[model samples]
Target: MGGAARVRRGAMRFGVERRDRPASERRAERGGTGRSPARRRCVGRPIAKARGMTHSPLRVAVPLGGTDRGRSGLGTWVQAVLPRLARRLRARGGELLAIGTPRDLDAYAAVLGEARPETLPAALDRAGASAGWHLAALGRLARRRGADAVLLPAANRRLSLGGPPTLAVVHDLAELHVRGKYHALRTPYVEHVVPRALRRAAAVVAVSGATRDDLVRHAGLAATAVRVVPNGVDVERFRPGRAPAALRAELRQALGFRGPFVYYPARLELPGKNHLRLLEAFARAARAGALPHHLVLTGSDWGAWARIDARARELGVRERLAWLGRVDAAWVPALVQEADAIAMPGLFEGFGLPALEGLACGTPVACSDTGALPEVVGELGVRFDPRSPEDMARALATALTHPVVRRRAAEEGPAWAARRSWCRTAARLDALLEEIAVAPGKAVAA
Candidate 1:
């Protein structure tokens, strides 16, 4: 579809009702300085401003073209952080120009009502060509808007060192640590291409301290250049005890599991996400009569899905397994709240969002002790060894059956999530950007 048509479609999809207005009024609303759209246009190019449009001190260009249809953990981070981050930047006499394909912009517009988004051609929507678009067009787009810096939210995937002054957010280095996380062809990009770009960035934001350490140790990035910025959850939206009984009933009926269940929200990928082992643990617990709750898995399939299904069947626990493929975002909070417990059996997690979300909903979480899960969950989660099914079954039992542990999680989870709000995250990010924008030369040198 054409870019303009996609924008219109996106606006319509989000219930952005259109109203006809005078051209001058529309121009005024868009911050144009009393000039007609045609008058400001340069014939061959799109016009961002009139002859005298006011310029914000700090204009940051955010590229979302490489973000995969707003799925995955990276997508969740973008949706949660960008709206708050945009508000923070605007409050300080700054502007955020989000660049993406029309569909991506549409997704952002749903959350960010006042976002100033520029559209890229739909051809860049393909995975392989996304980085090529960033390499060739991102800098030009930033330069057109006089952007002070470019913030790459998923920098490990899409990066352009030639851009104004790039600030990269590295979510995880899981592919480097976990074998078969990426295909053999894509492994080299994660190993070489991503690290090389991180080295040249003006500053790199690691989603967790564990990720920061990994960058320093494995990627050879300077510790000083890498800053640890943890991802935050929406406490208001994900708070405990608010989900209606109707919603819970609906969720239960949809999953075809009427009894209590353990919710594991993650992609069905092997070795890295470790769903196969989770199945084994579930079967072990079920057979021993140690666990009463059914296993409910929510996420899109990423290869190894067949293996997960086959393993469940072989273990004779397929009937007890509820695979709600790729759950809707609106249903996530209710799903978490209604579940008996949350399970994350990933081999390694840079920052375990499910653990945080589960805590926020007052749902007890049983997650792997490895990676940043320990750091995020702290004393709240029921930690276990991911490699051992015995340990996982034990943790799952505690989270589901232990009265004292469940009560403590229900009472304390909300407060724990409150401390890690998106507001605080945005403030920290604003400060970091301000520092880099204030002294670009020094930032680049470092």
Candidate 2:
């Protein structure tokens, strides 16, 4: 009658296969492992078999948050990983199960068409009230589907499903470390939900070693419990190419821009991104006539757009600023490739994927010297103190003026980006899954 009930029926119908049975035999006789009445039943039979059978398809359940109605950094990461994971798993004779809230189901379904998708109860949307019921429902569903492993694509409340081990990708430990920096509404959610999830996860993957260390130190997670898996770029999609004159013309006309442009491709989040400071820096540079290039701000989330617009006007650089709100995915690579230099002045980040991507497109980068940006950018680009507008202005001026620095960054940046790939990230994930399945005790906190 319900999703969980239907899943239970499916699992009962398919049953568990024996280790001794041939692949064809198992397929032909889809019955529960007919063990002797006197013998004890294996509580994790389906999961054990799923892991033990090297060639057998692994049924992985990946739970996601709501899809990006706005082109958000987190959304971009999800978009990059999910479809790639699905294809890779399918190729290795595995199936994927995408579980998300009703808001996320349609988008996830569209991306992972072949994989089975389950939407959680709509009542779970209420703040702080649905944790118990949500976990219970998720656990039952995962057990019914006999998931080999469950992947939480984003940090949320952890589900203690009895059937499968869980893997959570902690994008950052910003909530734990940078208190009172985010919106008041989010503070309670993070305080209650995130730490509990981190403690319960079988393996915690951080986007950078910096974030991993933060998790270990601040969240009381064991260092050995964490693994550093850096976010990667789509190399094939984001390569250097000539931007069509028509598109350039459109952008110029829309924004009243008639000169070379430097792009800051990120959401207009305050405090965390330090966007107000960035605007001040841009204004300082503009007033000095040091930065001849227009500044383009791309990707604005809800409630953030108006703030950024007001900041631009107040800075007196509204005419020089282009607010390209949520550009198409296909256009992003092209836009990055066309920019003279890509700037990320964020005060903190788990991993600066945009900087990595801009470098991959052979655009020189100028970013902050904080959080994971230094680790991600390495020696490829210029680093500035995000807190100081003067520092940012100076750095932008130098980057724009210095040909030798830009040349070296442009030459070396793509090669750096090329070294990290989604394929490689996925391979590492596969190994982690195997290790967790075979020797789960090894995954215990250090």
lDDT of 2 by residue, 376-439 (tens): 7776667788889877776666566556557766787666676666654655566566556554
Candidate 1: residue 50 Cα off by (Å): 36
| RMSD from true fold, candidate 2 | 16.0
Note each model's CA RMSD in angstroms: 15.0, 16.0
Off by over 4 Å in 1: 1-56, 444-446
Q: Show the colliding residue pairs in model 1.
A: none
Candidate 1 per-residue lDDT over residues 168-279, each given as its tens digit: 8888888777888876866788788887777777788988778887888877887777877677777666878757787777787898757878889998887898988899
Residue 81, model 2: Cα distance from true site in angstroms: 1.5
lDDT of the candidates, in the order given: 0.74, 0.66
All candidates: TM-score: 0.84, 0.81
What lDDT would candidate 2 get against the real structure? 0.66
Pairing residues by index, what is the TM-score of model 2? Answer: 0.81
* Weakest ten-residue segment in model 1 by summed lDDT: 40-49
lDDT of 1 at 233: 74
